[model samples]
Target: MSITNRYLNQLGPQLTERDLAIIRDVGRFKLMSGGQLERLYFADCSDTSRARNRQAVLRRLTGHRVLARVGQRRVGGAQRGSASYLYTLDVAGQHLAQSTSSRPRRPYSWYEPTVAHFLAVAELYVTLTEAARGGRFTVLDFQAEPYCWRSFGHRTLKPDAFVQLGVVHPDGRRRKGSFFIEVDRANQYGAKIETKLPQYLAYYQHHRQTWPDQSFPRVVFLAPHEQRVSYLRRLVAERPEAQRLFTVGLLDELVAVTLDR
Candidate 1:
């Protein structure tokens, strides 16, 4: 019964399967926009009808202290409707997620800086999901953040996301590939950020056979702009694995590159 998150304890009885699925998504993605939720879950409804229904579901979760609305209404025109608002799993939400997950997941308290990176990743998630839903691509698996993280020799390689996709070729054949994604906004400086590359290279060097595929996943670095892509490519150029294991591309190219046949 904390002041900020008052208890409803009215958890299980009122929750539907759809509600649980939404919770799982928030837990996995770290954060999501109201628009993302509507697209993923409420697409069955049309226009303003879907907006109203989504607002109701979100209000119900917030009342239960299972989801918390954070920050300002998104700029341009968010609070204007409901779509631009942002959401993250609340303390109670974490407990609800744990009830259904095989492995434990704990969400961090609301903060400002990490939101952009997380939301960027969430958008990629939406793209992949929509493509799969359209029947052209198959999302074999997607693990975000902690689930995608790898620990080897006392260090963890914390890629933004990990995915295995089934790609359909022009010839009507299919192929699969795995990748470790680093969605870089260039937020860090010098050694702090450069450490991630070496960590990934080292992991690839020593742990190739540990994956079920019996080889390391190609490491893809998605940056905000062409210059950023060039910058990351420069970093990759320094490493021996540069030509063999890494790829750097603009963020928007993710779906095309990942699902490329």
Candidate 2:
């Protein structure tokens, strides 16, 4: 038996299928907030029931040392009161997940500089999950940075994420929506962002040369606000090829479009 199975045997039978699923998601996403977990896992339950069940499961997992809470509580308005908790997989959780996964678990740290990037990616993931739940789209696959790296002989393209979406049509047909996401935090200059576009183009060209029958995924650049989106749009317009292979949108706009459509 694997070490994880042995640990579970010693811990008795407190864990449930739902608990294991939670651990897998935390392991995959690196970090997830309590609210995200509740929505993703217990969406079918009533609000009160979902909240109660989610908290109970989280508490149990934490108690078993399978998950650890990181990040400080957020103190703010009525919508987000001070009880928020960010959960990440602990050692036992990692072993359990890694045993089945082809890729090994990557290390994560909750330090200042990295926190914003992690949270942004998590927010995007949760938004996509919500869209899937609403029947607007089905998330065929989601690969984070570790698995999102692509090598093109002389160069490498590491997207923040790679998502394969099945968009639902009104006629009941599903269309494929593949995208490589580049998330920006409003810290980088427009020039810096523009420079990255050519790399995507090169990658697309290389992919087309290798597999002429396959369609290349669009490169979706998500920024903090509309102004940034507009700036990126102008940059995209500067290159006709980019207009075909790239898209720019505000984070809220992207989520809204996905959910509403």
Q: Among these predicted structures, which one has the highest lDDT?
A: 1
Stretches of candidate 1 exceeding 4 Å from the true structure? 1-10, 188-193, 209-213
**Residue 229 accuracy (lDDT) in model 1:** 83
Cα lDDT tens digits, model 2, 11-46, are 546667788778777777788788788777888889
Clashes of 1: 0
Local distance difference test values of all predictions, in order: 0.79, 0.76
TM-score per candidate, chains pooled: 0.86, 0.88
Q: List the residue pairs that clash in candidate 2.
A: none
TM-score of 1: 0.86
Q: Each model's number of backbone clashes?
A: 0, 0
Model 2 sits at a Cα RMSD from the real structure of 3.3
